[model samples]
Target: MTARPPTVRERRLAGELRRLRESTTALNLEEAAEGLGWSKTKLSRIENAIRKVTAAEVQQMLALYSVTGPRLDALVRFSRTTRQRGWWDVYENSLPTDYATYMGLEAESEWLNSYTMGLVHGLMQTEDYTHHVARSILMRFSPASEVERRVAARMARQRAWTERADPTRLWTILDETALQRVIGGPEVMRAQCRRIIELTEQPNVMFQIMPLAAGGHPGVVGSFAILGFPERFTPNVVYVENMTSALYVEDEREVHTYALAFEQMAAMALSPEESVAMLERLARQ
Candidate 1:
C-alpha cells in the first residue's frame, strides 16, 4: 500500500489555524466548536490538515476571536492560498515535504529576495549545471530513476518568469565569489552567467553582486530567501536552504530579522549597474 502523500498546503493552513487558535482564549474545544458552528471532530481535522479550511470560516473565527486589522487579513489571505496549486505538485513524492512547500512559495511569490554565499541558488542555476549539482546527490539516494525525475522537477521548478507577463521580481544578492567559483567548469559557468544576465534584463528582476571587498555581511552565515507574495494575503516568509533540507520561517520577529538582513545584504552588494558589469566580466573570463 502506498503511503498517503503529505498535504503541504493543507498542513500549512491547519498549522496556521492551530497557532491562531492557541493564541486565543478559546478556553475549551467545545466552546470553540460552538462558536465556529463546527463539530469538535471537524475542528480537529482542519487543525491537523486532514480537512481543508475555508477562508471565510477562518476569517469568521478570527473575527470572533478579535484577531483584527492587518494580521487578520494576512491569516485570511493565507487560508485562500492553501488552495493555490503549483507545477511542483507533480514531484511531491520525489522531494521532501519541506522542499515541496518551499517550491510552492517560490512559485507564487511576487517578490523574491535571495542571498547565496558561493554555490548556486536553485532559481539562478542552468539546467545542466543543476544536473551536475543534483547528480552528486543521486549517489546517496536509492532508485536512480527517482533521482533523475527529481532533478528534472527541480530544473522545471527553477523556470521562473521566463514567460510570465509580470513575472516575479527577483532581488538577489550573490557573493562575488559565487561568480568566480566554477560549479560545472567554464562552460557551465559561462552559461550560468549568461543566464543571470538574461534574467536580470527582465523588467521585474534585480540581480546584485556582493564583492569580496564588501566583507562581513549577514549572508556570511548561509542562504536565505524572503518571499513576498503578490496578493498581500500572507506574512512574508524566509526560506533558508541547506545541503540536506530547507526551513521556512514566518514568525513576525524572525521575518523582520531576515528582512533587515536582506536589506543589509543589498547595501553590501554592488549597485545594479555595477552588478551587470560584473556579470559581463565573469562571462568574458
Candidate 2:
C-alpha cells in the first residue's frame, strides 16, 4: 500500500522532533537509531513525517535527546494533539487529497488572505452559485452524485465564515472581471453578488476589486491564498491551485513572494468601501 501523505499536524511534529535531534551534538541518526533499537529507515520516516510518531515514541526520543521538564511535557502534548482529528477528516475520501489538506489547513487558520482572477472565492460563494459552478465544471466527467458530494463538501468548508466566535479574518482581492462574469445565469449571479455585498458588512471580512481599468497586475497569472495560524511557531503557507492539483508553499522565501504579490494586488484594487459600492451597483444591473 502507498504511504499516506502526512497531515499538517504530523508535518509540524516531525519538524520539531528533527530539530530536537539535530540540536544535540552527541546524537546522529545512526547513533540515535542504535540507541533506540530502531532501524535508520524507521527513524528517518518519523523525522520526515512519512509515518505518525506516537506519544510514547516522542517521549522515548526526547528522553534519549536529554530533553526534560516543561519542554518535554510540551512535545509530548504536541504528539497527542497531532493525532486529534479536525472536522475536515470526514470528507477526506470525498475530496482530492491535496484539496482535503487545504480544507484542513483553512479550518485551523486564524486569518486568510486570498486573491482570485475568476469566479467568486469558495468561502464567499452562495449555494446556488456553488452548485451551478460545480456542475458546469465537473458534470462532463463526474457523476451527479459525486458532483453533489463535492459541492456539499465545498459548502462545509465555508464554516469559518460564521461558526467561530471570533470568525476567521478574511481579506480577499478579486479581479473586477470576476464580478462581471455570470456563472449561473442572471438570477444566480445577481444573488451571488448580493451575498458578497452582505458579507462585506461582517467585521471579519474584507473584499476589494482590482478593476480592469487598473490594467495588468501580478494576480493576472492566477490566484492564491496565504493562511496564518494562531500558533506563533507555525509559519504561514501559500496555496496555489491549478487545473487538477494544488501547491502548498511553506518555505519562507516562496511564501514571501506570494505575500508581496498579494500586497501589490491589494494596493491596485479599489478600497473595501468602494468595492462594496461596486458590488451593489453590479447587483442592481
Candidate 3:
C-alpha cells in the first residue's frame, strides 16, 4: 500500500507543533526527545509531517511545550482530523505523488487563482477533452484502462467546484491559444468552450482570456496556480507542473511572486464579460 501524503491540515498541525516547541521551550531536538521519552527520529518525523501524530501524542507534545488555554484546545481538536481520508485517496495508486498532493490541497482551498498556457484547467475540462488530452500525454503503449482512470480522477476533482455547498472560488486566466488549439477536433473544442462559458455563470467562478494579442507577459514563463486556504495558519501554496513532475511553492516570498504574476496576467487578460463573448463566438463557429 502507498503511504498517504500529508494533507493541508496535517501539515498545518505539524507546523504549529514545531513552532510551539521552539517558541515555548528551551529544549533542543535531542533534549526535547529525551523530555518526551521518545527517540529523536520520532519527534522529527512528527514535526516534518512524515508520520501521523495521534491526538494523545499531540497532547503530550503540547504539555511539554507548555501550551495551554484555547490554543491548546484548538490544536488538540485539529490533530484528530489529520488522519481522515480524502475521496482522492482511492486513486492514489494511479496518480503521481505530487499530483495527488495538489489534489489534497485543492480540496481544502477556499479559492484558487490559475493561469493555463497549454490546455484547459483540469477543473474546467470537458470529459471528452480530458479523454483526448490524457491519451495524448500518457506514455505510448499505455493501456486504455490507465487512460480511463486518469479521466475519472480528473472528473472527480471537478466536484469541488460543482457539488460542494460552498464551492471553491476559482479565478482562471486561460491563454487564447488554449481556445485556438483544436484539442479533440472541432466538435470537442466547441463543447469545451461552451463548458467554460457555462461554468463562468456560477457565482464563485471567474474566467478571463489572455489574448494572443497581449503578446509576451509574466505568465509567458509557464503555467501555475496559487491556492488559498480558509484557515489563517494554512499558508497559500503555489503549484507549478511540467511534463513529469510538479513543484509546490510554500515560501512566503516565492508565493508572493507567483501571486503578483497572476495579478499582472489577470490585468492584461480580457474581462469576464469579454471572455465569455469570445467563448460564445467560438462555440458558434
Total clashing residue pairs per candidate? Answer: 0, 0, 0
Q: Which candidate leads in lDDT?
A: 3
Would you list the rank order by lDDT, best first? 3, 2, 1
Task: Between candidates 1 and 3, name the one with more favorable TM-score.
Answer: 3
| Ten-residue stretch with the least lDDT total in model 2 | 1-10
lDDT of 1 by residue, 18-60 (tens): 7667766654666788888889988887777777667888887
Global lDDT scores for all candidate models: 0.76, 0.85, 0.88
Error of 3 at 194 (Å): 0.2
Q: Tell me the TM-score of model 2.
A: 0.85
> Which of the two, 1 or 2, has more lDDT?
2
lDDT of 3 by residue, 1-285 (tens): 126667757777887787677778888888999999999999999998888899999999989988888777878888888877788777767988788778888888899999999999999999999999999999656999989999999999997558998989999999999988899799999999999999999999999999999999999989999999876556688899999999878777889999989888999999999999999999999
In model 1, the runs with Cα more than 4 Å from the true position are 1-12, 22-45, 67-84, 139-144
lDDT of 2 at 183: 84
Candidate 3 TM-score, C-alpha based: 0.88
**TM-score for each model:** 0.83, 0.85, 0.88
